[model samples]
Target: MPNAVSLAPAVSAQSVAPAFHEPLHTAHDDDAWWRSSVIYQVYPRSFRDLNGDGQGDLAGITAELHQLADLSIDAIWMSPFYTSPQRDGGYDVADYCDVDPMFGTLDDFDKLTARASELGIKVIVDLVPNHCSSEHPLFKAALTAGPGSDERAMFIFRDGTGPDGSNPPNNWQSHFGGSAWTRTLNDDGTPGQWYLHLFDSSQPDFNWDNPAVHAEFERILRFWLDRNVTGFRVDVAHALVKADGLPDWGGRPDGCSSDGYPGHAAPMFGQKEIHDIYRRWRSVLAEYDGDRILCAEASIDPLSRLVNWVRHDQMHQAFNFAYLHHPWNAAELRGIITDSLQAFDSVNAPTTWVLSNHDVTRHATRLGENNPEVGLDRARAASLAMLALPGGVYLYQGEELGLPDHLDIPDEQRQDPTFIRTGGERVGRDGSRVPLPWRADEPHYGFGSTSGGWLPQPEDWYTLARDVQQTDPDSTLNLYRSALALRKQLRLGAGSLSWAADYMDTDIIAFLNNDVMVIMNMGESDAYVPSGTVIAGSHADAGAEGVLAPNRCVWIKLN
Candidate 1:
């Protein structure tokens, strides 16, 4: 093991327990904090490593609480640190109530939450109720109990087809690729029943039809709530309840027609039964004193269908994926924002905006396409525009530094199941999930004292390290800090958006939120700057001056 580096003192949960239980942000209305809160997504394994074990842990997160607090984020939505098999990056949960040994113990998580609470940052943990690690004791017990037993009934288990029962029950495909079903072995080493796993075979889907499954998840929610988590980000929120009878999707021979959604009908998702689960969860959140909330990771299409998850009785917010997946064109973005506002407004729910997360190519690389400098500029512009919108926002870790996807990860070191299952035909999400760079001169970019973290970082990241960006006034990190401060000061999240219809058809996207004018130039040529005192901009050259540069966005204070 690498020699342990000293860390800031950790505040014990016992000492802070009394104050931590109380609400931290009394400045914001308790009933509406979740509506427009700026939440930062913390992927623990890639965030920071306190121990010299090459993987980030709870202690690392606790040590960084002050950094998030300084960023002015209202809450931190942590990715899973629960007892997991490390498959799917902790999404393959083996136990719901405990932290993984790799991440640290229960007390360590308690300390992390306690520190976060003290910093006025609410903790919202990831909750994967749709499935569990196959190695979980419950799953293992189901296997040992054989078919038709009470334990086996808790998970979706169906017999295979063909003469010797070799094929999967349905034609559904795994998100990671190949068949969605994995057959189990009997006592005699013969093929037994097949279990459904939408993502990977190691993560078996739960049978929500079973009341025992409901009871278990309810208990899991209470367990985390009792530990003082503000809320949950429900994983694959649209996928808990599969269509009745598990019908073949859209009569397609291979059943892989529409990627994640499967078919036009989407038999595997958007099922009506899923709402009842959220309704019950909403009630559970209501039992808590804080404005406990649920944010859905439902990848449902068409803003209309997506709005259902955020009805008053369900989730507080669902990710506005239409905005995330839209092209960087001004017209496309304008259309998506308009649609998102209208659709979400019908349900009286806030539209959550996110530019990049752990699952996709970072916006810096994605928007720039081929040019690195251009990508960084566009990313900054996008951040400014996203923050100006009227709703909650999620800032993926390292996004503030304008980090691009580390596209050069060696094939041998790749761990994502999507990469392995696809035989490297597709690069998968590993590029975007690389460990963050904290310091330029330190070992492993200061991720850990000993190593460069679980995944390799690009050498170019030295200049982009968090410390490097913090010192530079014009750096993307400082840009985010400035924008977040202004966002809070102006209460932009609580405001409403109004389009500058005169520029609607042009390549410029101009809008007003709470009397602050926001404009972006997506045209081929530089556009004449609008009449206003330029307050904040995506580029250093942006000021009360000549023209707004192409691929840049600006926030103006109109007199």
Candidate 2:
């Protein structure tokens, strides 16, 4: 370990128990913190390493709870840290009840949870119910149980087509590429049965049609919830249920052609059965005292269809990813924001906004065209704009420090199954999954007890290390801190958004959220900045007295 440092966030009463009092912002004025909390996501293996193992673990996370507390966040959403074969970054879970050796033991997880509760940070974990590691005991049992046996019924196993069962059972393709079905060999070395995998062959899709499968997941959820896990972020939330008979999607064009719905749909996704599963899962959460939440990573589009996943008692929130996936443009943003807020409103569910996460390119690099200066500007601009709109927001771990994607990651250092499976034609997500820089000048940048990080961080990351950024008041780190403080103070998340149609600058996006003036200058020239007491911003840099510099967003208090 890195010496015996106290893992507690702070020594205050607020950090120890619920007895401590803190000012509650308007929107979050209610006890349902899930509706308005700012959740910080920490991707394991890339977050911090406690054992000098070059991989992040629970102890490392416990050590950093203090830093997260300083950010004024209500909870931390952790990506998968369960037992896995590491095929899909822990998404391919081999066991649901235990912790992976790489992430530390269940005892370490208990200590981390206890420390987090003391720090007043609720913990949420990633739940990959759609698939499990092919090495799971159930899969092993299925492998030995022969065809048409009870052990094999929990997973989708079918006989192949063509003469002598030589071909795959279906025409479906794995989202990662190649055939979705993988044929296993019998004791005599004959091709036995084909099992379905939506992503990688190492992850076998469960047979949701089997009641035993549903019961197994319910037991798993309760196991975590019993350990005081506040909630779950369901991965592939829209894809649990496949269409009847597993039809071929190869002929149809990509997107919402199957159901003729307003949103994108596929035979493999947005199925009606998925909602019923959540409804059942919701009942399971109801058995607990705390208002446990289920957040969906449903990538459904066109707010209307996506809204269904968040209806009344289903998932408490579905990620509004359509907003994140939209191109950085004025009209596109306005429509998405309006539609999202309105659609979720109809269902009485809070809309969850996330700009970056473990799976994609960091928003900074996505907005910037191989230009750091331009990317940081746009990234900061979008942060305030999203935070001011209302409801809950998720912050990817390094995002507050303005960390950009490490686009030039060496090919050999890449470990993502996507990259390996595709033969490097696609770079995979390794660029965005680099270990976070902590101490400015420390070896391993304070990630572990060594100089080399698991994935090499960019050379310039020292400039954006959390330690350096915290000291620089004008840094993006400080900006996020200030904005979050202001957001809680002003009850911004409790408000409504209205367009300032009177502003004539097409390059600028101006709006009001509960009487707060929000202006984002997306143009080359400075746009006229409406007057109000400036609260928080990307920076204080200005052009003229009443104009905002290009690619900056400002929040002004309404008089």
Candidate 3:
């Protein structure tokens, strides 16, 4: 049965479906692959588990390369699998050069990278430069080295303000929650100076002002580069360089922007000094062959400010958070797409589009509101819209399967620091990071041999498994595969986009790219289907004559 929405109008005669083909994408410099590539974000712990350890690992990722290659993506960006305490989901790096025991060993990563290369897919690992795990040797040494020691200087350490030095150095709030500062115990077992942690207390922010810190990260980068990894997705890229003498932002602990920041002008992020770090990284990447890349997870706003990080000399790509966080409104999306293109064009950089990731709610749940069916339809429609944009795209794992955030995750099972820090006031990101469903009838939906992985999978996920969708043309997985195949065939990622004429006043998003016109109806009622040959669509009724349903997207080839 077609995954058609109830609101879709009855089908009449089919439109004149066209038979046409465009030349393959134009050739560019070897290092320019990232300019228009589709990179998949693999959340290691939840993707697949081959070891039956109840968590996904490197070997599991290797086992799934064939499936990823089948999707036609250019690369895979795996979230951190480094040796860590697993606090903050491996963002807290305990050892930069080794893999966590739970994930696998260094040899496992080597084999995974080699297998991925054989399938023509490049690998990009996560680099957490903004902070390190408290269990890291350096951080551990810093804690015992006292306030004024060189070991302590690697991180943000400061004297308290009160007479007895009891108060925190500043009132900055952590992204995880509560005070950003955590006091330590001196050698004599007395209350020592406070150290800063912009995220969880287990992850202490590094002081970029220290030259040794810079040298250490450079060494760590080379360690992986020598291992033949393509590049890195720099974690917390914008927050690496804080303002001189970290001042209080006066922003409340819970006051976060759509991109999860305390406003764009927060003193702790987007500091000018951050560019120097990227420039250095770019230089480091230039030393290696194969066009190694660096993608920044910078959430800086005002497209103008965010563009600076992707300047020709700095980083290859910075995520387009503005576009990701926007609602399903046609006008809003148009403005953001236009603004993003213009802003990135000014810097001679490609705008990266992403809808969901490890940190945020899945787009299906987010766009659907209370209606599961509506959300799935809109999510599919949104994917069509995002893929039509001209730039790099980062697809979070399992998004192709139309997975909703596991919103019913039990409170006791929640592990995100945000949940613990906020005392359940905010549910945190555990829902988005749940293990993926690969097989309908297998144990844990084929994630592992057990009943479930770390976080529980929704019982209803069986219907959405890849094995079930592979045979259904109208399934979300099939929709993504068809759209991706077309994207590559027509080279849409490298094509130019222009707003189609005549629909400017309507609630429909109509844009033309090369010989293809992408139309999405975001209005309350059915709208006229544009006159053309239907090529692909987000819904089964997309090829229907006369009208397009609300939250439906279709690609048409000019007659």
Q: lDDT of all the models against the reference? A: 0.84, 0.81, 0.86
TM-score on alpha carbons, each prediction: 0.93, 0.92, 0.94
What C-alpha RMSD separates each model from the true structure?
Answer: 10.7, 9.4, 4.3
Candidates arranged by lDDT, highest first: 3, 1, 2
Q: What are the per-residue Cα lDDT tens digits for candidate 2 across 116-153?
A: 99998999999998899999999999999998898999
lDDT of 3 by residue, 1-559 (tens): 1232233333223354422223222222334788889999999999999999899999999998899999999999999998888889999999999999999999999999999999999999999999999999998999878768999999999999989999999999888888899998888889988999999999999999999999999999999999998999999898888888777777544233444444565778888888998899899989998889999988776888889999989999999889889887777777888788888888778889999999999999999877889999999999998888778999999999999999999999999999999999989999999999999999988999976689999989999999999999889999999899899888888887777545555677777777788888876777776467789999989747857888899998766
Of 2 and 3, the candidate ahead on lDDT is 3
lDDT of 1 by residue, 1-559 (tens): 1111212221112222111112111122434887888999999999999998989999999998898888999999999998898889999999999999989999999999889888999999999998999989999999999999999998999999899888889888888988889999999998899999988899999999999999999999999999999999999998888888898764332222355544337777878889999999999999999899999999886788889999999999998878887786777787898888888888888889999998989999988877888888888988998999888999999999899999899999898999988899878998998988889988888888874578999988899988898899999999999999999898888876777645666677778886687887766666655466787899887643646777788898765
Q: Which 10 residues in a row give candidate 3 its minimum summed lDDT? A: 18-27
Residue 75 lDDT, candidate 3, scale 0-100: 96
- Give stretches of model 1 more than 4 Å off: 1-31, 250-264
Best candidate (score: TM-score): 3
State the local distance difference test value for candidate 2: 0.81
RMSD of 3: 4.3
